[model samples]
Target: MPGREIINLQVGQAGNQVGESFWNALLLEHGLDQSGAYVGTNPLQTARLDVYFTEVAHTNSQSKYVPRSIQVDLEAGVCNRLKSGPLGKLFRPDTYVTGNSGAGNNWAKGFYTEGAELVDALMDATRLQTENADTLQGFQVIHSLGGGTGSGLGSLMLSKLREEYPDRMLATFSVLPSPKVSETVVEPYNAMLSIHQLLDSCDLTVCIDNEALYNITTGMLKIKQPGFSDLNGLISKVMCGVSTSLRFPGQLNGDLRKFCTNLIPFPRLHFLMPSYAPFHDARTQAWQGTSIPELTAALFDRKNLLVACDPRFGRYLTATAIFRGKIASREAEYAVHDLQKRNSHNFVEWIPDNISVSLVSVPPVGQKQAAIALANSTSIQEVFQRSLEGFSAMFKRRAFLHWYTEEGMDVMEFSEAESNTKDLIAEYQQYQEASADVDYEEEQEEQEEEGQAFEEEQQLI
Candidate 1:
């Protein structure tokens, strides 16, 4: 048996059971059995690995948050087992004494500290490496980023790893919450920014949208039935699928691409808003510069993304093309058009009359996912050419647009906001620059200022 090794970490209430079950499924799929031991054995030349767990406080009294922990596991049994000391202890979970309930204003900082702890643990676990440096070269490291545990804390942890091993590959897979299940709009937005931070650091990132998978699997498996396992099976499959894919050495494929390639040629993407949205109509219908960054940041640069919106289905946005790979400008336009047509095939078409576009990019880093954005040209003719290319095909295909309407005034229309693409790029660049400095507070203050100004404008509009 060939052995493999992985350093696994999880934050918050998401425990070992969840990670183990997911890993077991992946191993079984590959015709390999998991050797209970943390090191390699001859009969099962099992993968030697380590595992760790950490739990964090949940924000809402009703919410359950788990701390971030790290572990290393190896596959091996009996005589083949390597002596375990530091490696063994490394897999054990450790707890922190703080329940600070991180101030809401600096919640990001608290989360970042949790990640810092994980980074410290990693250093300790691998300390022996300085003397026996070759021991870790063959092993792969896997981490997750999603929900509260992964998104917030996970980003901090992964950012540290990037600093340690700039050349080594680390994979992060995020399980995005379904719009309906996510209680707050800010949760997903935070997830996106956390992802942005990760993307700047990892080899590749794969994102699995809970909503889309739930829809697909729930329909086929029907969770209501006993033992159906319903969408849970889909979740397992997705996790196992991503793990197996990452184990191999090559171009990393993500769930986002899966949605883009296997699902309808084009999927509508939109950001949903609550009835309380003050500028839904103003932002949606009126032309404005300030909103573009939010629009583009929301729409572009996500993997396996079909649409954007909240559980209320308050607003909708869809994706059109893959930013990377062989896909071209013309083909991308056609694909978007095809998706729009399908959305409006019904008698009373409700496909968005206008769609927003923005350019975005994600450098290979802290994430193991894909990023996408709209293409722009130097002149109006070029823009018109791409628009015509996309719209004409959409009108012809009709399948690109889907017809669906929301009930109640709870759903409101907002002008698709525009986020100055240039501004976002600059902010990203600034973050990169500040990342090296010991003091990030000054830069963070600037970001808060920017956000405040934007919010103030929203209130004014």
Candidate 2:
């Protein structure tokens, strides 16, 4: 079967910057140059580039290359820099979409006003790109959940995409703001609003927390005070790891559909926690003689996780480890068995076989080995709890309420979003509790019988 075509939509400053790094990484991995010209013919390189990029015919020599991506921002500065940057020639000029002004970190303004204004133009660009695909797979949206353009406008685009292409899958690489160090005071509100929409619209949401990135840079990569570029580079590697399967077909879980099915069991429990091993930078020491077992063990470490959470506190519903680079299948099987033995304490008693492993032989540009562990564990509730507390604290004080109201959003919208978020948290908590033991089914059956008896008694009365 032919591989599916994926069009990338990057929104906001954070999105565009991350997209830049992602494309740069892609180029390096594919042995291509700044202008998309193949520099080396690596026998191991995969032939999946056309899925995410288009080959435009050159005017003079009939050679061409451009990314099948759409870049949007409320402010034109980031987009302008991207167009003028070294990799400018790799993007289609018409794919760069922008708006009149920035969203000013106000979700309501981005979603209600600016998003409404730009939806038509965004759809036009998307349709034009979609027409070129032989079999359109889905979309991968890169954005932060705390910024106005990323969260607000991103949410609006997600809803529209779902409406327009109901059958296609929609996934998001959502950059989550830190609860302790926030650039915007209303970041909690923005995050909640975006997450509410994501729960309803997106097929999968991969959350990358800012706090986790900070820790990884300072602790693992040993950067004193990492800049956005530094952090985005790390994120790009993780993105590459996750996309390895999609880029290179393997024995199991190569496509996005199978990947999602393996990781996400319940619809709302789709918040994934990823951890990449052997993270290296200039300052950090090279990973010396690390065995597959050691690398697999490192994946379970909290410090290596892309999102900060104590997995020990919650039960694992489903887990998938994607191993890339030079690793044997027997070695992978042994590593997975070792991981299972070590993680047995955290596995739910009902389902011991929830863990799975996929091996992708295609490694990153300059890496010998890498592993990404994606888990749908109940520990993500901690993140939701922290966000909810921050939101409730500010909402109770009625702080920053006028900013959204001034943007023409009804005050009731906040209440609705708050309610939805609370419900989501509760659902996660319920899943966690249900996964604790095998007796949950018996308890649910008894509760149903008791409720039916009460209804019968009421009818008799």
Candidate 3:
């Protein structure tokens, strides 16, 4: 049978920038260079590169590989820059979808106007990529949940994907803006609206927080003043970790569908937090002689996490540790034992085997060993809480309402979005409460029975 094929759809400036880094990482992992030529001949490194690219015959009797990826943006500058970059040859020129004018950070304009105008074209490109695949798995969208084109247009595409390909799985790697420092004042509005759509349509949504990325870049990577490029590089590493099984053969979670099935029990609780250990690059020398126990321990550290949240406080519905690079099966078992002993309090009482382990021998380029931890925990509730607070602060004063209202969006839409967000928050809270060892419902029933017994005794007396 043909392997699973995933079409990547990157929207907006943030999406495209991150996508570029992701492609670079993928190429490096597969031992390929910018020109699609093999740099290393390691037989052990067996990643199914054909899943994301198609080989075409060049005039010089050589084959050129182009990615099964679509790049969409409202502005032309970012897309143009990507085309001129080192990895430009990897993408098809026709896959660049741009609009005449930008959304100006207005979600309404991006969704109602630009999104509608470009939907047909976007679908056309998607269809072409899907047709090329032997066994089409689904799409993986990279976008920011707090930007106009990334949020609004991305939401539109997600809804359309569900309608068009109901059987195929849809996942998103959604970037969230930092609450402390954000570029757009109306980001909460964009985030809320996009989240509403994602909750309705997507199978899974992996959240990457900007504040967490900033922290990782500065503290972990040791970058003095980190830019988007630095953050994108780190984000790409997390994506690679998540995608390692899909690319290479593994004992567990060998594809996107399996990965989702393992992590997500409830549809609404699909927001995942990822953490990768032993952060290194070309300039930074790889740390030598690290034990599996130490590496596994680092995966649970808050400083290593890609999202700024405390999973220890909230319950973890599901968790998986994906170990790449020189890790033995025996070592993996010991690591899992240690992890379970240390984190028994982190799991839900209902789930018997909530934690899973997947080991792959294919190490990340220039690293001895690396591990990624993916957790579906109620800790993500804080992220939504921040978004709700921000949205409420502006909505209470009716700030920036005209921007959306003038773009043919009804004022009631805002209320509906807020209602959906509140519902989502409630669902997470319920999950957190359910994960506790004490059953509040059972306790309440016992208390009621005791009161009834006391009343009967008093009557008899």
Point to the candidate with the largest lDDT.
Answer: 3
Better of 1 and 2 by lDDT: 2
Candidate 1 per-residue lDDT, tens place, 260-305, comes to 2322212111111111001112224344332222322333222222
Candidate 1, residue 52: CA error in Å? 14
Worst 10 residues of 3 by lDDT: 280-289
Ranking by TM-score: 2, 3, 1
Residue 344 miss distance in model 3 (angstroms): 1.3
Q: Model 2: runs farther than 4 Å from truth?
A: 44-46, 59-63, 281-287, 435-461
TM-score winner between candidates 2 and 3: 2
lDDT of each: 0.33, 0.85, 0.86
Runs off by more than 4 Å, candidate 1: 1-5, 14-18, 27-110, 113-119, 126-146, 225-232, 242-461
Each model's backbone clash number: 92, 0, 0
**Candidate 3, superposed: residue stretches over 4 Å from native:** 44-47, 59-61, 280-289, 435-461
Error of 3 at 248 (Å): 1.0
Error of 2 at 226 (Å): 0.7
Candidate 2's C-alpha lDDT? Answer: 0.85
TM-score attained by model 2: 0.93
